[model samples]
Target: MAIQRRGFIAAVGTGGAVGLAGCTGLGDDTGDSDNTGPEISGETLTLTTTTSTYDTGLLDELNAPFEDRYGVTVVTVAQGTGAALETARNGDSDVVMVHARSLEDEFMEDGFGVNRRDLMFNDFVIVGNSDDPAGVGGEEDIEAALTAIADAESEFVSRGDNSGTHTKELELWDAAGLTIEEFGEWYIDGGGGMGEILNQASMQEAYTLADRGTYLDMQDEIDLEIHVEGPVKDGPDELMNTYGIVAVNPAVHEHVNYDLAMAYIGYITSVEGQDIIESYTSAGEQLFFAEALSEDPEFQQYVPEGWGSSTDDE
Candidate 1:
């Protein structure tokens, strides 16, 4: 959905990629008397989400139909994944859409969120200049490529803002047996969103880990190239990136718009929603794969991916 200016504004810092949009007027019409759920009309749903979604312009296409269907406005605050979850935990948001699972699990276990759903997915890629200064090009092994980059003392840009991409970058470093704390000047911490970090990497010709969608969306604006591929390009699974949507727990924050939040969630996970996600593309490439309509979904689709019988026993 194209973001509208009527009551729509974003907390700035998604790299100025797209302007914010919101619905103009609230919907006060009550549906049929037999409807069992809360009325979402005339409500404003506050959604805290990762910058990747905002930066790639997916929200414009994804949220428009939902807003029209419900006659509600969606106010988005795009930030790093960690910051997004924190916003929900603090009762500042009605819902969240983020990609960092570990952080999401903590939010759920702490009773700040509920109704988690596997929404959509893409993959992470290691990008750098075409020269491939660290000699990491064509390597399927993400860890090895990272190690080589470190060993060569090459410039590496980090989203150090605690975003999902930052979390994945740290995971890759750990897998490579390299503590980022030990690295020298070659490591650059870019405390910004995905689009900003990509721009930073582009200007400096440094290496950075980024979601495939954001990279492709800004490909024309930046000089950086994909030095190593993620699962989307037949690389390792460690680079697989999945995003989730969860509503803030009304039990934790009664002021939150729980009804409208659930409505938004239901709309995004429905068959029509899945199709919208599937059809969204950038740079002539599909950005995310819809996961909600799978015929054989996992139990974790409704919980954390690592949850199982043992977690339940505990």
Candidate 2:
């Protein structure tokens, strides 16, 4: 069920890697109606996004102004990038915001979604106890760090929910010449959000891969510290975490609101939207870079007709 809130969006960061919440702004009566409850206005738009956005409170910050200006009640179902893409594939959401490029490409190629646009980027970090049991602290190479953690059996937590971070973690492990199936007792399949897995790691005093922003936001609540911060650019691409927004193809589900979804896709890549993302910070540090503003060919994509952002009309 969607969490109903007045102008404020509720914190639905949860386990199981999937949850739906709704934020109604000025004069918004639309809710995440199961269609059993009161029928919401046609202005309601559904956004299936990643847990990173919610855990870092960036979703609330970015979506609040969108709701306020458009008077659209944004019904959000947050899940891992994989699960969120699955939601869009099942025709259960209007838009999908996630970071797994391979999965996102698969979805688009298979005709499950359209209008994919690169929005922002952040890097992944390996974090663990202050004691650095895995000896991964200050490590420059992610694969080597994972090798150390696996070799030492340093009690690691894997988001195993197949989120973007989890995907990257697995890739790193494979590159480290190890398979998750080979992981010993030190490895745990954390079937939850980033915050949940981090909490578990904190309780177990284990190590885990995490997004920089969420970890920073929850540092006080957890004992984990950044053991490694991959460069968002000028480093190996595996370390980069680029987020994208896509409109769920209505052809797959006629019930979906394609127009509103396109509107959101447009809004997120717009100059104003990019500015909002750029301004958001945690602990006095910018959490995400507005990649939409970058002319990087890899970040360029097709924006909906009449909706491409003025920031970087790529």
Most lDDT-accurate candidate = 1
| lDDT (Cα, tens digit) per residue for candidate 2, span 1-314 | 12111131222331211111121222234454443532234488888888889878888887876676566789888899999999888988999999888788788878888778778878888888899977877777778888888888889888999899988888888888998886678889989999899999999999988887788788879988887767752334568787888888778789998766766666666666766787888888888877664433443454333333586575
Error of 1 at 220 (Å): 0.3
Residue pairs clashing in model 1 are 1-60, 1-61, 1-64, 3-21, 4-21, 4-22
Instruction: Give each model's whole-structure lDDT.
Output: 0.84, 0.76
What TM-score do all the candidates reach, one by one?
A: 0.88, 0.80
Candidate 2 ranges beyond 4 A from true positions: 1-42, 232-237, 295-314
Supply the TM-score for candidate 1. Answer: 0.88
The best candidate in terms of TM-score:
1
Please give the TM-score that candidate 2 achieves against the real structure. 0.80
